[model samples]
Target: MSVIAVLALDGAPGHQLTAPGLAFATAARHHHPVAYEVRVCAGPGFAGTGGPAPFGIEAPWGMEGLDDADTVLLLGHEGFRAAPPPGVVDALLAAAARGARVGAVGTGTFTLAATGLLDGRRAATSRRHTRELARLYPRIEVDPEGAAVADGAFHSAAGVLGGVDLCLHLITLDHGDPVAIETERQLFLHLHAQAQDAGGAAPEDGPGAAEAAYNAVTPPGSSLEPVTRWMEANLHHPLTLDDIAGRARLGVRSLTRRFRAETGLTPLQYLLRTRIQHAQRLLERTDDPVERIAARSGLGTPANLRHHFQRSTGTSPTTYRTAFRALVSGITWPERPEQP
Candidate 1:
């Protein structure tokens, strides 16, 4: 099990700390034989946010816990508007020095950036704070809408609810795409149902926002859509830019330039992402055999599939499938849970 230490300082955003805590805890409970051991540590003299209602949280560990953790998550609070306190920066710097994977949620990047750990690194901070973050840390690339960004050993999220995205993304990192897909299906469907009942689509894709963002940059007739469709259809067959350009009736130069403009990725890179995305869907939603899945995703051999799948997600395809199947069928790990 990976050991995670969450460093909570005074005035910490309540949800920022609790979101990761609950996500890992729920994952541990549902999967059993816990995939992680989570420690919630407080900085010296930390009294939390003091709450609208009084409460007390006794810390069993302190900054020292961060030293032993495989992953250290920094929780940022209102106090982070200025530079992080000296102690907080020290603990984060030490964790990074020891080669630990580090991350932040929402404005927590402020603290991580203060340590100089994020210099020349990409990070995500809350949209409201994006300009300030950029102004403060000119060396750190702040992506406003990016779900999460991993620069070297640092991972960061852009907003409050991006916590769920961060957790699911970490699930993708720790388990595999298949596991991540199943977890996303569960969480997404629940959230979607809640949003529908609340009379609004989810904030990420509510009404015209997604389309507006898409159109604001790339108008219709851009090279991305057609090439993307072609890749999806011909993924099983060997593909080439010449063939794509011919099918799309565009010159290679036009196709390449426009494709990159629309998607921010080269045509071949987009093809690979599409293939992997398809394979991930298959792994999560189907009982198809692995060999068939490899062929269906245009990935060809099982060895190739395993190689890229593990490379992208950190776990074997079979392990991913087993975990996914268990989760979807309402079965827990180790021993299957009862199915109705």
Candidate 2:
């Protein structure tokens, strides 16, 4: 069984404390053979007085709980801007030194940064804090666009949803794609049901009602949801601006203007990004040859796929696959003994 130690600092967000456990429990339920032990470790001076409400939490473990954990997660707290409390930095350093995967969620990156572990590494945090993090730690590269970042054994996430993404990512590294996908599906369904329950009454087709309903679930660019969903469904096809414009029932120029205005990308650019993301998923989950994967992802040829994959991800497709598999298997190939 793998042990995940969540370090809950004073004023820690309730979501951060519970999200990892929820994700791992869902994963364990989906994949019966893999068991996970999630322990919440209270940091110094923690009184569970923070988050959206005032509540009391009695953590089962203390800082020492991180000693033998396979993964140590630092949860965001209200006082993240301040230096970490005594022994917190040392404990994180020791955890990293012992080969445990260390992660931070949102402002928790500040605590990890206090340990200098994030120095000279690309880390992600909430966009609101990216400037502050960079201003404080000039050595660290803050990726505002990334939802989550994984550099070696150190991971960081942007916010609550990003924290969930990070947890699913860790689960993917441990159990591969199917389990992670199932876990995400379950979570999505649960959240959707909750949204419906919270909504209570059916929305009437009054002025602004449609807009409110749309904004409730979708982001700013979601006016083009149908078009984007169609684009995703047909990524295997040779789609062009004309095709997308036709689908959206707009002229090419109009479509380009609206697409860029809403989604901040041209139709072609969005399609390419979508294609690349699809290719990455195929690389992670399938053993198909590069040529087949390329065609399936609408990148046309293996050369085209390699060119874009390398450009977008800074690594070749083959190399990315090998590295990802190594991460999933938890093996460093260089240290493996040669078979007779």
Candidate 3:
């Protein structure tokens, strides 16, 4: 099991504790190979099993428990920006050195920041606290508006609800999209389903939310829609810029300029992302070997697939496939709950 330790300090916000706990607890119940072992580990002046918060949690472990965890998570506290207790920073550093993932919820990024793990890494905290965080930790790259960001082994979420996004991201890391999507349906569907509806026709665009975030100023319709659609449909065939330009009925320079103007990414960049997305789906849904998946996803070979997959996602293809398969055998999470 992947041991996950939630570092519970005095005054830590209760919501963050419940957020990840709810997410992984549900995953353990539903997912096979039983992934995460979540324990709330407390610090000085700590309350017993009862956690701080709206849920009235009673944590089972104390600060020492974090020493053996695979991941250490920090929750926001009243004085989160204040320096941590004597051994807290050392413990966090020790965990990071051992390749354990460290994450924080809300202003808890400030607490993690104090430990220097977030230096020169991207972190997201509540927009309300960005300036103070930036001033305090000038080396850390803070995204004030981000829903959540996982850069390398360090992860940060903006606020209370951002905690949900962070937890989902972690689930996706541990079990891929199918399990993560089911967890969403169980926990957040009724509340967020409508917000998720702001998408365009699938053939015209590949996933609207990501595109919008990458290039919010772009217009709705792309002038090169047909070419993009063709690229999406033919990802398995080895493609080059000349092929794309020919499809656009334009010279290389003209196609490049227009595509970049219409979408923030270049033609090849978009193609690469599309191919990677396809590979992710296959890894989640099929038992095919990495070599076959690479060929099907236009990555050409296992070596090539590993190169791009690790670049895009921080983990290798084999690891991703293992995590995905561990989540469920063949169960696809329902799109909506059945009416009672």
Per residue, candidate 1 scores C-alpha lDDT tens digits across 1-340 of 8898987777665655666766775455333223687898988667864343324577678888888899998776656767676687888888888899998877677888888988988898766778899998899888877567988899988644526667767766776554455455445434433444486533432211211011011223554555566678888998888888888788989888877666555666667666766776798778898899999988899999988766654456776565555445652222111100
lDDT of 3 by residue, 67-150 (tens): 889888887766676788777889899999989999887777888999878989989877677788899999998887856798
lDDT of each: 0.67, 0.75, 0.70
Candidates 1 and 2 compared: the better one by lDDT is 2
Per-residue lDDT tens digits for candidate 2, residues 1-340, read 9999999888876766778888888676534445799999999999984635557799999999999999999988878888899999999999999899999988899999999998899998776778989999999999986477999999988754527878988887886665577567445434443444466722232111211000001122357878888988999999988899999999999988876666456788778867876786788799999999999999999999988776665567786676555445652212111100
Candidate 2's TM-score reads 0.59
Give the candidates in order of TM-score, highest first: 2, 1, 3
Q: What are the root-mean-square deviations of the candidates from the true structure over C-alphas? A: 15.9, 19.5, 16.5
Tell me the lDDT of model 2 at 59.
95
Per the 3 Å backbone cut-off, how many clashing residue pairs does candidate 2 have?
Answer: 0
Candidate maximizing TM-score: 2
- Per-candidate TM equals 0.55, 0.59, 0.54
Model 2 ranges off by over 4 Å: 197-340
Indicate the residue-level lDDT of 215 in model 3. 15
Clashing pairs in 3: 49-58, 49-59, 50-57, 50-58, 51-57, 51-58
Error of 2 at 16 (Å): 1.3
Candidate 2 lDDT trough over 10 residues, lowest sum:
207-216
